[model samples]
Structures are given as C-alpha cells and as structure tokens.
Target: MTAFRIALLATTVLPVLAVAQQMDPSMQMPGMGAGSTTEVAPPRTSAPAQAGMNGDHDMGAMRGTTSSLPRRVGAKRAAPSPAGPLASHNAGTMDGMGGIEAQREMPNPPPPPAALSGPAHAADLVYNPSDMATAREELRAEQGDLRAYRVLIDRLETQFQEGGNGYKWDAQAWYGSDINKLWLKSEGNGTYRGRVEEGDLQVLWSRAISPYFDLQAGGRVNFGPGPQRTDAVIALQALMPYSYNVEASLFLSNKGELRSRLEAEYDLLITQRLILQPRVELNLSAQNIRELGVGAGLSTVEAGLRLRYEFIPEFAPYVGIEYERKVGNTAGYARASGEDVGSFKYLVGLRSWF
Candidate 1:
C-alpha cells in the first residue's frame, strides 16, 4: 500500500513542476533562463505603456536579437544571387552593366565552312580515285555545266501571191549551257521557180544578260542573188512583258553601211492546242544600196496574223495573212523596179523546235 501511494504522488508532482517552469521564467533550468549566457530580448511592453514612450524612442536599437525568443524558428539565409549575365534580364544588355555575353549576341559565326574540311571528294577515299573524279565531274556537269543543243525552226512557210509563188524561212540552232551559247540563225525569201532574193546567216556568241533576254554579238554573211557582204552584228533577243518575243539587231556592213531590224511576236491561246500569233518586223537602212534595191530610212515593214493548231508544242502548223509594205525611198525603188510597194499574201507554215 505504501509503494502505490508513492507512485501516485510522483506523477502528480511531475505535472506541477512542468507547469511552474512554463509560468515563471526564473523557475526554468539554469542555462535556459533569462539570466543565462545567451542574451534575452527585453520584456514586451503593454499597448498603453508603449504609447506613453517617445514616438522616436528607437525601440529596434535597444531590443536584443529575437534569436532567443520562444515559440519562433530559424531558417538559413538565401544564397547571394549570381552577379553576371545570367543574373537578371538587364545583365546581358549593352547599357554599361552588361558582360561579355551581351556584347556580341549574334548567332555564333556560322560553324567554320563545313565544305572545306575534307578531301575535295570524300568518295575518293573509298573508291578508285580516278573513277571518283570521273563521277564527280559528271555530277557537276549535270548540275550546271552540261552542254545542250536546240533547233528552232521558228518559221518555215510557203506563200501564194498574185505576182508569183515563194517560200520564206527563219530558223535558228543553238548549242550551249544556260548562260552561254553559240547560235546559228538563217532567214531568206525566194520564188519557188527562181533563185533566193535575200538571205543571211549569222554565227553569234550569245550570253544571257538577264533572266528574260540574251545579248548576242557575232558576224553575219549575206547570201543569194543580192550583193553578198559580211556584217558585224549585235542583237538582243528577249521574252518581254506579257509573253512577247522580241528581237532587235543592229548590223554594220563591210561596206560601211548600217542597218537595223526589229521583230516582235506574241502568242494568244485560243485553246490549249490552238493559238493565234500576231507578229511584226521592221527593217531600216541608214543609207541606200542601189545594187540591192534598198533605200535610206525605213526600208520595209511586214505584219502577219497566224492561227495555228499545236498538235504538239514542239510542232505547230500555221496559216496566216501577211501584209508587206515598202516604205519611204524604198517604195520609189520598188516602183522603179516594176514591183508593188505594198502587198498582201496568204501563207501556211510549220513551227518546230527541239
């Protein structure tokens, strides 16, 4: 019975001691109390007591650090933020505050040319060098420098006239790559039963000066029944606005004579396979050539309207009406020669290109 009473008394006394420690500061264990080595904050003042003090009493300066306070917890201070470019948005700018990362912000200069790093042909390493060279050359040729040729029989037509029957031809063949070509152009008119009246052949070096035009410089040789001569020629051939094909040529004859010719033609599609083409050619001479029945100023002008059915784009047969006029002094020369100054003829022709 004495042992049970002693256990009960011990439990009651322990609770009483804990309550006393919490209610009274002086009752706490020695090191944990207000007078211990660790500093203690000043006792807090009641609201009325704080109001009676001077407003500028500088309470924070007098109070000790709250590190000793009860019912409070402590945390580690945040690490100082990095101070360079990645620190803030303004760190990479040019305004005196920015670092190296800000000064040259353009994309890293294009990775040093990938082209020049290896052998001229990497295949050369694994294949027979000679065969590789040959294949590489073929690739370049097919890509850019390949040679090609085309023959365009732009005009091959026979004419029926009150005076007589005649044929006319204007054709060109060119051989080259896209930027440079050698051109052969020929044109002539003659009666069916007689000799060629006027004809010329041109050997030109043509260079593409624009996407739509070529500038050609070459030599021309006149042939047929007329006075034979050689001329230096410079010409422009262009596909102009609205799909108009234009050719203008200036010629300086061996005899110091100058002449020019301009031709323009346009195709109007009536149907995918049927087309109407209206074309004009003007010939002008700087001076008269009595031997050739030519005169100064405008020599001749011809205009034609043709309707063609293109069975295939590479070949088209056309039938057309043409009006030809001899102008200025050339008209007088034609009259003197017992020829008509103006005439209209109907013709059929085939246009082909390859």
Candidate 2:
C-alpha cells in the first residue's frame, strides 16, 4: 500500500512541471511556482517617437538633457526674428516698414516749366542775351544804308483833242526816306492855237499816313493865258482797293477861292503786257472865279478809256477816246465864251515813268 501511494503522487507532479516549462516566460505570472521572477520594463518615451514621425526634431535638443515638459507634436521652433521695432510690422501693412516707406521719405525732383514742356510751346522759349545781341549785329551789318533820293516822272505824255488839238504833261520828283518826302510836281496843257491853256507847279511835303496812302501839303502856282494864281493845297493820294490809283486835292486860293479835284484810274490786264486803263477826273468849285475860267459847283468832268501794250515796264503807248463836259454855271460860262459845253476826242499818247 505505501509503494502504491508514492507512485501516484510522482506521476501527477511530473505532468505539472512539464506544462510549466512549455509556457512563455513573458506570459508567466508571478508567484506561479518556485524560481519564477516578475520584471517591469522602463516606461517608453513618446516624445522622441513623435519627433521622429514629424521630422522636426532639433539635433541639439536631441543631444541635450531630456525635458519634463511635454514637447508639442509636429510643432517647429520659429526662425530668429528680425531685431528692430519696425521688424515686427508686417511687410504688407502700412506700419512704415519695408521699401515702400523708404521711397516715401525721399525728396522728388521738380517738374519742367510749361514753356519747355512741349514742341508747341517753342514760341515761349528764351534766348540768351549775348546770342540775341550777336544776331542783331549781324542783321544790321547785312542791310547797309538806305537811299535818300528818288525821282518819278509820272506823266510826260501829250493828249490831242479833236475840236482843238492840245498837249499835256505831268511830272513829280521826291527826296528823302519812305516816311517823309520833299516833292516837286508840275502839270500843264497847251492849245493848238499857240496858247498855253493851263499850267500848274507845286512844291509839297508828303508823309506816309497809311500803307497805301500819302498826305501831301503844299503850295501851287497856276500860270496860263487868263490869270495867274497861287494857292495852298492839301491832297491825299492812295493806291486804293481793287488796285485803283486815286488822288484828291483841295485848293485854297490866295484870293479865298476854294476849288477841288478828284482823279482815279485803273488798269485792267488783258494780257501780261496788254492793259486797258480807264480814268476819270472831276473838278469842283465853291465860288465863281470867272477870271480863271472857273465857276461854282461842278466845273468839269473828263473820262477816258485807253488800251495800251506795254513793250517795257517803264513805258507804254496808248490809244484812247476821251469825253469832257462842263456842268452847272461852268456850262453857262462856256457858252458865254462861245466854247463848246461838251467835246469828244481820240487820243494817242505815251505813258512813261521812272
């Protein structure tokens, strides 16, 4: 009976030991059997693991002492910030930071003057005084001196009338500058009967009053068969509009007689060298001066139309027809003197000027 009990206990204990040997050591519990030990691994650090995952771990921090404060996952240490007060301001905001602010502090250049701003403003350009003086001197040197004397024989022609052939002449000469002139004028006519019908001579001071007009003040002497008279004369001579030459004169005789004359002439160019000239002359009187064959009101009117071919600019030969008539008391005087009150004539004349 003792041997049987011992054998049963040995068999059970051997089977238990074999099962314990097959179990894993980590899975084994403490106090499970004799010679078994319990072990606790050091707590794992999650920071280094998280740092490695985020790829932002600082090498220096990794080598330095571990920190008790938990490190932020995926957070980066910021770069060293700029050092001044302005540095903290955003580059895009208007806190007076950055290149834009620097530009604002700079002084700008002034704009150009209006006169120098464009091509159209060139008229306002200024010239240096020295340069202007030099230009004026050069111009004066180029011009030289002006002429002091001039002579013109305006009419040295003869006219023949049908009833009583007659000859006529007019001439003038001047001395001095364009603005003022000393003038000598002469005009006369002779009848076919060997008698000097009318003659006049004048000395005038002429002044330019306008571009196309001259004012003449002078003394006139009339000499002929009937009577001789001296008169003071004031005259206006002009190159009128439409290229008409006009002369108007008022005479105050020494005896207080007043007389006036108006004459106008125009040349029509049929060709460059061929011209037709029409002329009219009117004489008026304020009182009868029967001694001079002059009467009051309209005394005489003469009209002529002449056609000439100018062989040269200074000379032209003309053939013309002229009509003369006496009016008012002048016509009565003509009849009292047994002279014709009206007359018509064919004329051939030379018109020459110098």
Candidate 3:
C-alpha cells in the first residue's frame, strides 16, 4: 500500500515541473498576477514570417524582425488573376506592359505589292493573253527556220531530177569546126568529079544516158558552098573499146529539096588522144542525076580510113582517103553532059571542139 501511494505522488510532481519549465521568466515576475491570462500582442506579421513560422510563438526569440519590416508596402501583390479573357485584358492595360498604344510606334502601311518587286515578281503576278500569243509566235518561227534548213539540204542532195529518186541531170553543148571534102565517081566509067568543101560551124547537144551511151542531135552549115547548104543530124553513140557512132541526116539545099544521108564511124583509140577511124557514108537523092548536075546523079557510097591525132582532147588533126561510086541516072547525066561527077579523094582537115 505504501509503494502505490509513492508512485502516484511522483507522477503528479512530474506534471507540475513540466508546466513550470514552460512558463516565461519575464511573465513570472513578482508584480505579475497569477492565475490570469495576460493579453500580449502576437508578433507582427512579417513578409516571410507567415511562410516560415509555426503556431508555437516565443516573443523573446524574434530577432531581426524590426529591420525586416516592409520599407514601403511591397508594391501591391498582384491580385489573383481573374479567369480567362478578363485577366488578359487587365494585363494588357498595365503601364509596365504598354497598352494597344504600342501600335502607334509602327511605320506607315507597306505600299502595294509592286513596291519592292522585280520582273520575276511581276511575272508571278501577271496573267494575260498577249504574253501567250508572243510565246506561240516564237515557237512558230523556230519551226519555220527548221523547215527551211531541211529544204536546203534536200535541194543540195537531189541535184535536181523530175522524181524523188535523187538522180542528177546533166546537159552538154559542143561545137566542132571541120573541113570537109567529097569525091564522086562512076563505076565502069572514066568520069570523075571532085570537090573540096568545108563547114563553118557544127553545133551539137548531147545527153549522157549512162557512162556507155549518148543520145545526140546537131546541125551543120556548109559555108564552103556558095548557096549555103545546111544539114540537121541525129545520132546515138556507144562508147565501146572501139567507139562506134551512127548518124542520120537530112541535107537541105538552096533549091528547096531535102536529101537523106546515113553515116557511120568506128574509132579505135591508139592513145588517150590519138584514134584511128574507119568511116562510111551513103547518100541518096529524090530525083534523077539530070536534076542536080554537080552531085553525080543519085546514089553514092563512100568509105574511108582516117588517122586522127588529138593535140588536145577536145581537138584533133585528121587525114583520110575515100573512094566514091555514083550509080543509076546519076551516071547517065555525067556521061552525056561531060560533067565532073565523082573521083577518089585524099583529104586533110581538123576535127575540133571546146
């Protein structure tokens, strides 16, 4: 029983001692009244004191509180922002963040889009029909230029033929100056007539069908004849190893009559410029020998061999001999009229051209 009482007493005393220890010494002074709650000013609220201080207050522990008091009221705490657009409007009006008045400081409005532009800029902005038309015209001119060049190439390549075959055409003109002679004679008779004659000009035209053949036409004027006899000749020439030429002619006289003559020659080339030619000429007339007294009647045949040496490829000198025979009424006229009708002839002359 004594032990229990002692434990109870110890517990009560411990509580009393804790209460005494917590009491402020200054409040416990002699004049202080006991058993009364003294009214004390809680430490003034501080800028950060509210944040740091807990409810347990010791007035004696407040150091640096006086100096820490607001110098002026802290520039008023920004009110909690109102919601949404209202807060944005209030913020925009604040002097620190200038109002819409800031727009007044901007430069005047920019000029039109043309103000700082170049041709490329204009091109981008432009749309017009005239520009399209100019482009089309340029394209057409280019096409025409290409076509013209093509035509020129075709002309050069063709050398000009009737068809599209591209075969070339050629024409040639030639002149031959010749001295001619004829001798006429009657077979089985002593009568003979001979004459020396020459032509002033012989003009010919020829078309080369190929390398080997030629088609020819020409005319000759016999200036040696006082009456001016002329002849038109047609021929075909074959260029063989021994070149062969055949010609048919119509002889015209002052008397207004036409006589046909055929002549053929074979030429053997002895050199590039020299040739040996064997030739034959036959003459026939429409009338009896009595009509043309000088020509020894009607049918005449002459054959000869000639040697021609070309001084230039286009010119040559020739010497030949020919024996001629006159037949039919031509022999009769010559016998009765005692006219010089035909003979054998040896002649020299030039065969030439340019």
Candidate 4:
C-alpha cells in the first residue's frame, strides 16, 4: 500500500510541474503564495492556431503579446468604400447634372445672348451694317441652299441585240432644295439607222417624303412610233434597305388609259472603283389601247447587268448584257407587226453626271 501511494503522488506532481513550466513566465499561479520567486518556464512550441488561442488570456500585461493584435493603431481599420458620385466620374452626366444630383430637377438655363440668337453675320456689328448685309446676300446666293441643280446623262449608249444594233438615251435634270425639286426625265430608244421605236418625256415635281424616298407628280408626253399621247404621272423613287434603288410610276392618259411601271437597280462593288449594276424594269397596262399597241395585263420587262469602272466618280464607262421582252397584248401586237418580241443584247455605254 505504501509503494502504490508513492507512485500516485509521483504521477500527479510531475504533470502539474510540466503544465506550470509551459505557461508564460510572468503569469502567477492561482492559490499559490505571492512573491515566492519561482520562475515560470518558457512557452511550449505548438501549432500556430494553438499558439494564438494560448496567447489570448485575461492575464494583465500579456494582452499585447498576441500575434493577432495590430501593432499600429490604424492598421486594424478597413478601407473606405466608393460613393459613386458624379465628381467620381468625369464630373457630369449628359443632362448636365454634376456632383450628387439625385432627385433634383435641373434648373432652367439662361437664354442665349441676342447677338448669338440673331443673324450670324457678326461683321455687321463693327462694319457698316448695310454693306455687311449686302456682302451676306452675295454669300448666301453663292452658297447654302442655293446651288441645288444636277444634270445627269445616266445612259447614252448603243445596243447590239440579235435582230439589229440600236441606240438609246436616258437623261435627267433637277433643280431645287432638299425638300422639293423640279425634275425632268427623258428616255428614247431607236435603231441606229431607223426611227425612234419608243420615247417619253416626264416633267415632274418631286417632294421628299422620307430620308430614303421621294414622291413625284407630273405629266408625261409619249412620242415616236405609237399614237401621240399625254398622261398624268405619279411616281415614287426610293432607296430600299440593303442599298437597292427602286422607282415606280403610275400613268393615266387623256384617253382614259391606265398604265404603271416599276424599276429596281442594285450596285455591287467589286473594288473601290469597279462596280456591277443589276437593273430590272417592268411596264404594265390595265387596258389594251390597241392604237398604242398596249397590253391588257403585263406589257414588257427589261433586265440588264452591267460592269463599270470609274475614272472619276462622275464618269464611268460600262459594258453590259441586257434582255428585252414584249409581253401579253403588247407581245401579240409586236408579233403581228413581225417585230422581235425578245432578245438578249450586248451593250457598251458611258455613264456621266455634272
């Protein structure tokens, strides 16, 4: 029994000594007499997390020793966040609000000065106003909204078809402002040594309806081989999406004849100066005006493809293949007169504008 008691005391006493040795040197033992001069052992080597937990304690004078505590006063503070204010941006929004302008109505801006709102000729202020006015008048006449005239010889060429070689011309001239214009168009075709087979002149007034189209109203006079005729014309010229050009016209003749025409063209660019143009035209009539050799249904269609190279933008020389066919009653009339109803023609032409 005496040996057993000795072993129990040894075990308990050794463990208590070991725990005391591992504690911080300065910390006092609980329930132990004060000023005993017993030295505490150095801290034991342990895992970092265990060191942190062990380092944190209620012991006075030991609080600053923990590695988790900030060394400098400001080091523990988080960074300030952004306010998303206008000055943080380029200082202004498009509506002219600056700074933190939320929920605030923009104040009315001051009106412009009288000089800024008046005629732009500021020379009138320093020089003789009348002389400056006269100078401004001359400038206005030579510039801005005044030089609105264009004359184009769109096609003036000869055709080489299966039957015989022929020549044709289509030209237009217009003079006016952006919104309104007087337009003249004429087209005629004839055999090289023969009379004009078909010809017409249209004198029209054109009004812009949209950015891409114009509405035109006018008169048309048909001349040449057919019966002399006068007709009222209404037309539309438009630039369709994908850059197609379209023209449609309705004609009501003095003899109560009704007819219509539609034309469409597209330009495909092979290079900066090379272009391929494909064009198609259809003519229709509601009644058979036999005197004009007209059709009751569809009358005619002309389709052509041309490749041109521009020397200057205003001048291009072209070579093309064209197919012309007379249809319906018009074809019957053409056949009765022994005229060729359809043919494929190879043509060379100059296209120009000034």
Candidate 5:
C-alpha cells in the first residue's frame, strides 16, 4: 500500500514540475520556494498593457524590451533611438515609435547670436530726420554751384564749290554755368591759294531761352577781301526736333546793310562709327551792297552731304559733295563779276572736337 501511494505522488508531482518549467522564465510558479525569486523575476506588465492603462505608450520601455523577444530570421527590427532617453520618453506619449523617428529627423534650432547674423537692433539702423535733411541740402547746394565750359569747332572744313577749292571754319567757345554764358564766335572762308574770301568774328552774351535753345546778342566785325564792316548781331542756336541743329542770325551793318542767314544740319547714323550729315544754308539781304557783291532779295543757297567715319568720339575724317548757287539778283551780280552763278564740288576734310 505504501509503494502504491508513493507511485501516485510521483506521477502527479512529475507532471506539475514539467508544467512549471514550461512557464515563462520571468514568472515564478505558485508554491515555489521564496528562494526562486533570485533566479526568476515577476513578469513585468507589457508596454502595450501599461500604455492602455495610462493612455500613453512608453517607447523607451518598448525599445528596451523588444530586443529580448524571439524574432524570425529575416524580420526587420525597430531602429535604435539616436536621441537617447529623453527624446524617446517624449516620443512615447506623443506618436509612438514614429514619433521617435520624427524627433530624430527634426531640424536643429538656430545657433546662438554671432557677428553678421543681423543688425544689432532696429533703432541702430535708423537715421535721424534732421540729419538726413541736412545732408540733402548740402547735396543740392553743391549741384547748384556747379560750372562747366565747352569749346567746339562747329564746322572746320574745306569746300569744293562752283568757284574754286576753298576752306571754311566756324567755331564757338563758351564759359559759364547752365543759365548764362560768355560766347566767342568766328567763321571764315578762303581760297586754296591763300586768298581770304570772307570772314567774321563776334562776341556774344548767351542766355538759355528753353531747354534746347539759346538766344545770343552780340557785335560782329567782318574782315577779309571786302572792305571791313562792323555790325550788330542777334542769333538763335537750337537743338531742334528730330535732332536737327539749327542756327539763325540777323545782322545790321554800320553802313545800313541788312542781312539774314539760316542754317540747319542733321546727322544720320549709318553705324556706330559711321555717320552721314546733310546741311542746308540760306542767305538773304534787304538791300544791295554793290562793293560787297550782295543782292537785295535772296543772296545764296548752299546744300551739302558728308559721310564720315569716326575713329573716336572727338575726331572724324569725311568726304563730301556740295552744291551752291547764287539766287535772284545775286546771280546777276556774280555774272557781272565773271564768277559762276552755280557750282558743284567734291571735298575731303577732318572734323574734331575736345
């Protein structure tokens, strides 16, 4: 009877021991001695269970425990946290493992202040109103006091006209500020062999009458082949519309001769360095002056075309053709003097300015 009781106890206890061993290593079987606590710990509540209880997952805890689980051979594991414990802890309550990933991908905050980061402060970049006004007034005063001068040879050319090869020069020089100027003007023409035909010199006071026009009042002295004559002169010089340069003048001589002249010129640009200039001039008289070979009505008409190539802004060489005719009574006067009534000539010349 004792042996049978022992056998029954062995069978029952052996099965119970097998079941206890099969349980989780972290869980202690009931009725196991208290000393087994050292070998096996109480089973911890799973991270998901704790998350359900507290309404927030603990990602750090999950990451800490996931490494111990049995995994398939090719299963991908969660990436390790690079931000360490604090970020992982915050990520747990927010967006779980994805929140941790986001935290890792977050942009870093801007660095501390340094030179050239920005202006020191708003007030430091602002200018005082009074100071700005003072600076502007100084600039205006400087501009108002500015002065300039120019000397240009308006025409310095040799002409081949009906009579003979001749040279002509028309030049003006001025010194002043924008509003007023002292002007000196000179013009002359002479034969190629040194016989001066006619010439004049004038001194004028010029004032700006418009944006593109000047009014001049002056005295002129005519000198050359004919008897010298002094005259009172008034003239208008203008940059007309379409870029035309025009000048018109009237003269009252000491001997009571009345004469007027009109001249116009235009430059057409063929290229950056090539130009074609066309010019027209007309002369008229109120009464005939016998000694001077002048006529009562129309005196003369001249038209010319010149093509020049500029080597620089200040200088050019040109070839041109000119046609001149004595008109009305002037033609009769020319005929009586044995001079041609009309003529054409080809010319070459240099034009320059500074």
Candidate 6:
C-alpha cells in the first residue's frame, strides 16, 4: 500500500510541472502578463463551411480577397450589368428622316391656258379674287370646244336639200311650157333646118343618186300640134361651185318611136342663191320613121341658157333661152333646102326636193 501511494504522487506532480514550464514563453511576449498568459495558436486551414465553426476567422477573410470578392456576397460591389444589344436601335428609327415639301423651285410652265380643271370639279373650286378672271377665261375656251364637237357630229348625221353627207334620194315632178318650138323650115345643100313651131307643154320626173350624180327616167309628154313624146334619161351632176351635168337617155314617141338622146349642162353658182345653167340636148332615131317631122331617121341638137334663183336649198325657179337644129337625108328633102331654126325661149319652173 505504501509503494502504490508514492507512485501516484510522482506521476501527478511530473505532468503539472511540465505544463507550467511550457506556458512560461507567453509571459515574455509584449502583450502577455505574468501568471496570466493564455496562448492563442495559429488558425488551422479548413473547408469553407468548416472555417466558421472552427475559430479560424482568417479563413473567412481569405475567401473575400481582391480576386475572389466579386463572387462573395458583400465584398466589392458587382460591375454594372451591360445594357442589352438592342437598346441603341430606337435612336435610328427616325433619325435620318427629312421634312416634307421639297418641290417649290421647279422651272418654266406655259400660261394663259384654257380650262385648268374639268367641268365636274369646277363648281367645287374656291378661287381667290386674283384668279377669278383667269378661271372665267379658261371656262369660255372649254365651252367653245364643246360646241364645236356638237356641231361637227350634227353635220355628219343630218341632211339638207342640196346634199347630205354625199347621199341623196328624192322624187321630183316638173311641168313646163315652151314659149317657142322648132319647126323644120328647109332641107338645104348639106344640112336640114327647122323653123319656130307652136308652143308646147313638157312634163317629166327627176331624181339624184348622190351629191355627185343624178338620174332621170321619165316621159316628156308634149301636148301640142307635134306628136306627144316620152324620154328617159340618166344624168351626172357635180357638186363643185362650177357645176357640170351629163346625161344619156332613151327617147320614145306616141307613134311607137324609139330613139336615144344625150344631154349635158353646166352651171355657175354666182351666189348661194343664184345659178346660171347652159344645157344642150341631142337626139337620134333608132329605126326609120317616115311619119311626123322626123323623116326616115332624125338627128336633132338643141342648146339653152337658164338662170335660176334658189329661194331655199331644195327649190328654185328658172328662166332660159333655147335654140334647136335638125339633120338627116329625109329631113333635107321634106323641108326647104338649108333651112334651120333658132329661137329665144322663156321658162318658169320649180326645182324642189323632200
């Protein structure tokens, strides 16, 4: 029992003495007090989470150093976030746009014009006083043009008694008295002649095919001492101021007479109302006819001048003078030799149309 006690006391004293000797170094440091020294050991390295629990405060500070602070919670402030790439696009949306109305300085345009705008819009215009006169002048010019077009169309479609667009169709009746008639006076050396016979009445029908041509197919029935006669004719009438007419006809008499005749006329239009026409007629017998004044065969030529005044486009009254002559072998023997007839005839007639 005495040995065991001594061993225990020795063991306890030795450990206490070692601990006191180790702590003596702390007293020699600047901040350490005698017998009050408490040594603080350098902090141990640890994981980020373990550093907080371990009493190693330097580990937390080390994590927030300059290079690592941007990742840390409350160290250096974060760099400002960059603006989006599209933020500057709106500045150019209207940046280059210019103003409206850039054409005030153009050059040279004509003036003193007719209607500046159409009739449909004219009433809606608000003209300044300065422009009123010009507008009125232009309106007049436009109206004139309209009138001219209207007249042109009217002329093309309408017809007059004289001529209608070169087309004509009409029926005409004529009755006239010859004041003097030719009678065979002599059948002389080489030619036969005729004397003034008694007056006679002539009747016929006339028509026009166009302004430039005319046709007459009618009978001239003579009511006098001479045998009654009938004649059919076709004539071409020109429309120029100096008018010319040529005709061919078939002549027939009451005594079964058949012959052909050709006639021509020329007229001068001295005025719109007055016309002078000179007419010539020739006759030839088809078969031998010993009866009447036309012996065996007959050939007659007649000429006349007619002066007329047209009261209207369709109607005119004419007065004229005429002369006639006859020729044939039988005519020379039947009448006195070398006898010819010439006379001044007066005529009054109506020329009309529908």
RMSD of 1: 15.9
Kindly list the per-residue Cα lDDT of model 2 for residues 1-354, writing each as its tens digit. 999899999999878655644443335355454344433222356877756653433332342333333333223334444553335445676565656777988889777596456754243347665676777667655563233765555554456666668877777788866678888888887877788788999999999899899999999999887678899999998998889999999999999999999999998999999999899999999999887678899999999898888899778888888889999889988899998998887777777766
Q: Which stretches of candidate 1 lie over 4 Å from their true place?
A: 1-136
Query: Whole-model Cα lDDT per candidate?
Result: 0.84, 0.76, 0.50, 0.82, 0.79, 0.47
Q: In model 3, where is the ten-residue run with the lowest total lDDT?
A: 148-157
In candidate 6, what are the lDDT values of residues 1-354, reduced to their tens digit?
999999999999878656644443323445544444343333344577454563523232432332211131212333422653333434434444322222444556886457554544454356664477677678766763222110011001111111111111112233321211111111111101233232222233444455555444444544334554543433333343446666565656666678765767776888989988787877777776654455445577778676778898666766655556676744564465444443333444444543
Better of 1 and 4 by lDDT: 1
**TM-score for each of the candidates:** 0.64, 0.59, 0.35, 0.64, 0.60, 0.33
Model 1, residue 136: distance off in Å is 4.3
By summed lDDT, which 10 consecutive residues of candidate 2 come out lowest? Answer: 66-75
| Steric clash count of candidate 6 | 10
Deviating ranges (above 4 Å) for candidate 4: 1-144
Residue 322 accuracy (lDDT) in model 6: 58
Candidate 5 local lDDT, 1-354, one digit each (tens):
999999999999978656644554444346655345333223357888656654443443453343333333223345656775355355455547877788899999777766457654433458775676687678766786456778887677877765467888888888886778889999888998877789999999988999899999999998887898999999999998889999999999998889999999999999999999999999999998888888898899999998989999778888998888998888888899998888887878877777
Deviating ranges (above 4 Å) for candidate 6:
1-171, 174-242, 252-256, 296-298, 311-319, 329-340, 346-354
The residue pairs found clashing in candidate 4 are none
Between 1 and 6, whose lDDT is larger? Answer: 1
Arrange candidates, best lDDT first: 1, 4, 5, 2, 3, 6
Error of 1 at 113 (Å): 9.9
Where model 3 places Cα greater than 4 Å from the true spot, the runs are: 1-242, 251-256, 271-274, 289-291, 294-298
Candidate 1: tens digits of C-alpha lDDT, residues 1-354: 999999999999978655643443434453454435432234566889768865643332342322113321122223435553234333345466554555566466666777678887788889999998898789989998879999999889999888898999999999999899999999999998999988999999999999999999999999997678899999999998889999999999999999999999999988999999999999999999888778999999999999999999999999999999999899998899899999999999999999
Model 6 per-residue lDDT at 96: 42
Task: Give the per-residue lDDT digits (tens) of candidate 4, residues 1-354.
Answer: 999999999999989877754454445457555445544344455588565653433222232343332122212323223542222344465454653485376577677686467656667768998998888888877675575899998788889977689998989999998778999999999997789998999999999899899999999998997678899999999988888999999999998889999999998999989999999999999999887777798999999999999999899999999998999889999899888899998989999999
Task: Output the worst ten-in-a-row residue range by lDDT, candidate 6.
Answer: 149-158
lDDT of 1: 0.84
